[model samples]
Target: MVSLKSLFDLSGKKALVTGGSRGLGLQIAEALGEQGAELVLSSRKASDLEKAQAHLAGRGISAKWIAADNSRDDDISRLVDDALGKLGRIDILVNNAGATWGAPTEDHPIDAWDKVMTLNIRSLFLLSQQIGKRSMIPNRYGRIINLASIAGLLGSTSTTQTIAYNTSKGAVVNFTRALAGSWGRYGITVNALAPGMFPSKMTKGTIEQVGMEKLTAGVPLQRIGDEDDLKGAAVLFASEAGKHITGQILCVDGGLTAVLSSS
Candidate 1:
């Protein structure tokens, strides 16, 4: 019989998490670190990354911080190179770096659309491509977990009109499928995690303006997602248990996508 602990253990694996300074990326990094993976975390701000590294170390996890901006090609290249140099290998990659902009369809700025697309879609693909081409492809073993959104799977009734965000996330879903299909034979698995409403720096202001009760009322589970919500799915994908699963979008939304009424 397979021991459950063994199935989830990542004793010697090396993981690189983009945008891991705070919010969902940090949460995912913490989860992966708890599972015994050596982590290389990157984000835009050096100060925030240092603080995050300290926090992870306090939890008894080995972590390294690299200041990187995903929006720039040079920064992304340096990030991958730095991780490879420090960690020796990147067995797992969590492309959780993303950006969002909101505006009415009619008034949305072209620059905002470009920004969202570049960060959320273009950079994600480029980074993943680099990791695969330079590291994972040669090793013939890799696990990639993309941070997609329920916004990609379904439409939202919320007041914010995030047209570019929705479009970018939708692209992410398809990209996961395409990459998974192509890389499966190479012993690589590409998948996506679609999250529902969660409280983070991104949503804090929105929740404050709309109130928690109102937000919770729309979730079928009657609550927003928490840090714990990010752990199980991540462990699944990164562990031996999820080896057979690929090219799929696992929705972590609280039944919000399944049920018509979130009320």
Candidate 2:
């Protein structure tokens, strides 16, 4: 019988986390690394990647960093190639690089919308395609975790307007399910994490704009997500413990989505 601890262990597994320089992406990286997965972290900024690498090293979690603009096709190709060259194989992938532009739907800029979609959803597909075809499919095993959002599951609020971000993440949710069905025959499990208010660079502005009290007021748990809130869920989806799980979107929202569902 497989021990529970052993089921969650990711020893010897190699993982690639996009947008790993900070925010929720880094949290997930910490999760996988702590579970003994070898890590390759990627983002657009060399400085941020360097900082993240040092941060991980401080915790004794070995990590390699790559700086690349995943919004472009060439960069996506290069990222996959370089990651594979360095790690030899990618057993888990975390699609976490995303951006948001806040504006009323009528005033939302077309260029900004394109930017969010390209990075959030397009890059995810390209990287997953390259890695799945080049490694997981050939090896017959893989775990792909896409970063979605509670916003995707619900519409925008009066306090916030992120049309592009919400649409793209909704796409990510379905993308996770569709990809899982398509790839499960090859032993690849695809899942998504739909997170709520996590304090990070990307969310700092929203929290500030919406006010922390207002943000947490409606949440059943009455608080924003802490640094470690997502760790366990991320590891579960990335390790053997979740081998039988696929096409599921686990929300780390402190019961926010549940409240919305019942209301």
Candidate 3:
């Protein structure tokens, strides 16, 4: 019988988290690092990475940082290379870097749509391909945690006009499912976290525009996610505890989706 602590222990595991400099990415990074995973945090800004590294250090978690823009093919390649160099090989890959544009479906800019799709979906493929080929597949063990949004699950509401964001995340839902099916034979587990409305750089504009009270009004919990909300789920997926769980999309949205399903 596997002990609970042993199952959840991530000691000596090496992880790479894209967009780890802030917001949801940073929160997940902190969770993984605290569980004894050695980490490489990546983002577009070197300065932000520095601050994140310091923040992790203050928490007694050591982490390495590589600055790369996840949206660009070249930068994505370099990020994988640098991360492998730092950590020897990645046991876990967290594809958290993403972008969104708030525009109506008909008036959305093509370039903006491309940007969202490229970072949210394309980058996940590129990084997973390289990392799987170079590391996880060869090792026959890996855990992939994708950052999906509740926007992916629901249709457009009157308060929001982010067509591209919703569409790209919806693609992520299928992508997570498809990849898990393809990669499970290789001993790799792939899953996604679908967060409802968390206060972050990405959602700040939407929250401000929609108003916090209105956003929380319909949620069964009457609040948005807080800092520590995603930690347990993240650690579970990254550790042996979740070895048997794959292709699942766990929503951490304060029962917003539950309300949606019932109403």
Candidate 4:
């Protein structure tokens, strides 16, 4: 019988997290690292990566970082290679690099749409393929977590105009399911996290613009997510506790998705 501690232990795991310099990515990194997983973090900003590296080290987590723009294929390739070089084999991967453009549907820019799709979906595919082919498939063991959003679960709202972001994440939901089906034969599990409103750099402007109370009023929890809220869910997907779970999107929302919109 597996001990309770053993079920959640991630010691000896080598993990990679994109966009790990800040926001949800950083939070997930902390979760994995705290569970004894050696981590490799990547993002576009070297300064942010440096800070994140220092932050993790300060917490006694062994971490390495790479500066790469996930939207670029060449950079993604380099990132995977460098990550493998640093970690040797990636047992877990967190795809969290994403971009969003908020504009009226009629006025949304084509370039912005392309930008969101490229980072949120295309880059995730490229990195997952590289890592899976190089490590997971051969070893017959891996855990993959994608960062999705509640917007993907529903259509665009009049108040928030992020058509491209919504579409990209909707695609991510299915992508996780489809990939999980293909990779299960190799003992790999793929899952996604659909987080609600959390105060992060990415959502700060939108939260402030819309007002936190207004944004969370529909939620049963009646509050915004704090820094520690996502760590447990993230750890579950990356550890043995979730070994049998795959192709599922776990929403970390404050019961917002459970309630039907009055409209």
RMSD vs true structure, all candidates: 1.6, 0.7, 0.8, 1.1
- Over 4 Å off in model 2, which ranges? none
What digit string (tens of lDDT, one per residue) describes model 2 on residues 64-137? 98899999999999999999999999999999999998899988999999999999899999999999999999
Superposed by TM-score, candidate 4 places the C-alpha of residue 116 at a distance from the truth, in angstroms, of 0.2
Pick by lDDT: which candidate is best? 2
> What local distance difference test score does each model get?
0.90, 0.94, 0.93, 0.93
Put down candidate 4 lDDT per residue, 197-253, tens digits, no spaces: 888988988988999779888999999788788899999999999999999999889
- Candidate 3 per-residue lDDT, tens place, 87-139, comes to 99999999999998887788889999999999999999999999999999999
lDDT of 1 at 261: 42
Give Cα distance to truth, residue 225, candidate 2, Å.
0.4
For model 4, the superposed segments whose C-alpha errors exceed 4 Å read 261-263
How displaced is residue 72 in candidate 3, in Å?
0.9
Q: After superposition, how far is residue 248 of candidate 1 from its true place, in Å?
A: 1.0
TM-score of each: 0.96, 0.99, 0.98, 0.98
Candidate 1 C-alpha error for residue 7, in Å: 0.9
Instruction: Give lDDT: candidate 1, residue 207.
Output: 83
What is the clash count of model 4? 0
Off by over 4 Å in 3: none
